[model samples]
Target: MRRNILPGLLIVLVAVIGNRLSPNFLDFAYLRDSATLVAELGLIAVGMNFIITSGNIDLSVGSNMVLTACITAKFMVGGMPAPLALLLGVGIGTLLGWLNGVLITYFRAPSFLITVATMAMYRGAAKALLGPQSVKAPSGIVGIDTQTFAGLTIPLLILLVTASIGAFVMQKTIFGSWVVAVGSNSRTALYSGVPVARVVRTSYTLTGFICGIAAMLMLSRLGLARHDLAMGSELDIITIVVVGGTAIQGGAANVIGSLLAFILIALLRSVMGVANFTAEYQMTIIGILLIGMVLANRLPLKLILQKLRPKSQRAP
Candidate 1:
């Protein structure tokens, strides 16, 4: 609960500042529309929360998203049915994620290194497949963002449903418990009969599944897929996870916190755009914020306070 306060406050602060910058900032319809834009990122962040909570990371998520999007778009443009293309994309994403898990568990190497290598490989594969070109998603599959049910966009609804399910899985189920245990201490968990390898692999695979969904949404909204799509998005995704108060090291899962953090991120970007901040400036600010949150999470509160105190008042 304490971890949620900063993001909640930041959301309010951004909204107030946004209202000052643009009349539409506080407009419900405008904000609702803006929510659609970040829905893809939100989806990925939810899965990322699972990955981090399981004590693993997937730097290849952005690449996975792009690769899935590209493949789906290519097939759709090549006259395949939209439904088939979407399923194919999800399957490919799942396979890619499973591959990452296999390599990590089999080689017993750090997930960070494994994912970093796969990240490059996946991106390269996408680039090779779609060299210097973009493919238009089929009209049948496009416009999902514009579709509404009960006055909410499909993307937003999807995010809400996914987050809700994720929250339940993380907090209530046996699988959730296993993930937490594995992340907290793999050796201990294994000794206690927990399937550590399977837990970690499942987490990564789940993240890939979510990434696939994100790719579909992105393709639907943008109507185009390129190798470079979602480039550098992993940064924002990780930032959302970290800011949501999920432990970066492992053993924690905060799905609701992640959902709220994503909203804060979306609002911050909206406010910055309304204020006419350049993309470069927006990224720089977000990067700094990510770093700050990481430090705040890693440092001990007493140590932080001690440093803030004057030398004359320092503890002996």
Candidate 2:
């Protein structure tokens, strides 16, 4: 609890300091927009947390979002009902996720290679469907333009719902226990009667499902969809998950931490935008932060702390 609480407190502190530095950051509109952005990336990060906690990675989330957006765009362009179109988009995303799972589990392929291939395939399919064109949303989707609830954007609402569900799953379910166990040791989990393969496969499926949800929110927010949507979001998503304190090697994970991390990254981007920094510089800073966190994870900070403890207080 202390570990998780500390990161969130740090995020709040940074946000407060950032807002103080730039009064615009405290503007209701700016904060709302930041929440929306965090929600989008955070949704996928939550699923990634589950996957990482289950001892695997799903690199196909970006492509999955693209595919979902493309499918929704195609349906909307063809004059389909909005609800039906959205449903189709989600279904397509889930199917793609299942495909990833099947290949990785049944065929015994490495998850990294399988997801990488699927990522290309999914993105290629989106491009082929849309072909360098973009499509706008049809009429009647809520909050596409000129609306707000309690000063919060609709996208932020979506993000909040998604993150809440994710937190619930991680902290209050048998599936969560299985996820941790699988990450710790698949062999031991399997021997203990846990369905290791099934758990992993399900994680990818959930990843796709959440990406689909993000796709809908993004489409609604932008009022348009393009094959190129979320072109480089995979890196951002992974960075948020890592920064949230999920182990890359897969054992422990922090869903709430991932949420806070997403907010932190979004705030940083917003600050950078306000500061008029070039996009390249912002990316460089993010890259540096990612490297620093990775290095921190690898270091024996725990052992060092133990060694530094007072002799009287040290464990026997």
Best by TM-score: 1
Query: Please, what are the lDDT tens digits per residue for candidate 1 over residues 59-107?
Result: 9999999999998888888888888889999988888888898899989
Q: Find the 10 residues in a row with the least total lDDT in model 2.
A: 139-148
Q: Pick the candidate with the highest lDDT.
A: 1
lDDT of 1: 0.90
- RMSD in Å for candidate 1, one decimal? 3.1
Model 1, clash count?
A: 0
- Stretches of candidate 1 off by over 4 Å are 302-316
- Give a tens-digit lDDT track for model 2, residues 62-87: 99988888788778878899999888
Off by over 4 Å in 2: 9-21, 142-147
Query: Which pairs clash in model 1?
Result: none
